[model samples]
Target: MIRFHLKCDQDHAFESWFQSGEAYDKLAASGMVSCAMCGSTKISKSMMAPAVSTSTSVTPPKPSAAMLAELRKRVESASEYVGSKFVREARDMHDGLVPERPIYGEAKPHEAKKLLEDGIPVLPLPFMPSKKTN
Candidate 1:
């Protein structure tokens, strides 16, 4: 298998695994490959440095505090916080009782599975701030 670092036009970076380079080319040419975030068909491999073995020590650069703060702000502003009631609120919205809106919150793994099984759209946030912060 081969792994490619891919980027969409929106600059969302992700990785895709393929059987081979030819397989990737075929899928991409046919528009079968798309960005998970934006559903954009305009995807391409991003340039990446060759991987080194774990035996070779390498230091990864950390994001600046300012950058992290900006990211946290963006996350907070982009979605509504439903807190621990994520599953209930999500179900309500999905059932057309509450108006649908972008939301982020905590849910048990089983709750998430149930949401998926029910065909309700939900995605876990990478980070969740404390309720007091909101």
Candidate 2:
């Protein structure tokens, strides 16, 4: 895996691991890469130098599967699933055209980027929302 330091149009910097340089290029071209802070899809590689970690360096622990599962459960229980209409629903809520409530749904990368650019707050949940049907 190769790690690249990337920044979004909003100038938030974060590092992500890709399978290879080509993998990063393809994903970026497809607008799949997003900012870790704002979820913006307009990302570019930032200038970075190789890091050399010493013995004194500390690493953060990864969350366990159990923890992630529990989080998914709580979020799913609290939010309404809006499916493919996520972008419109979220924008309506943000604009006060609809009553604001917790919601989870699907969005294309470009849709998400537009939402962020419009200053609407949204987040990508760790798990796909279960589709609700009558």
TM-score of each: 0.50, 0.53
Judge candidate 1 against the unseen true structure and give its global Cα lDDT, from 0 to 1: 0.71
Candidate No. with top TM-score: 2
lDDT of 1 by residue, 34-125 (tens): 66566676999999777668887887566567655655666566567878888999899879899867567889989987886776655444
Q: What is candidate 2's lDDT per residue for 25-125, written digit by digit as tens?
A: 86677565666456677999999898788879788567568756765666666568888888999899768899877778899989987886776656566
C-alpha local distance difference test of each model: 0.71, 0.75
- Which pairs clash (backbone N, Cα, C closer than 3 Å) in model 1? none
Q: What TM-score number comes out for model 2?
A: 0.53
Local error of candidate 1 at 108, Å?
A: 1.2
Model 2 deviation from the true structure expressed as Cα RMSD, one decimal place = 11.8
Worst 10 residues of 1 by lDDT: 125-134
lDDT of candidate 2 at residue 103, scale 0 to 100: 78
Worst 10 residues of 2 by lDDT: 125-134
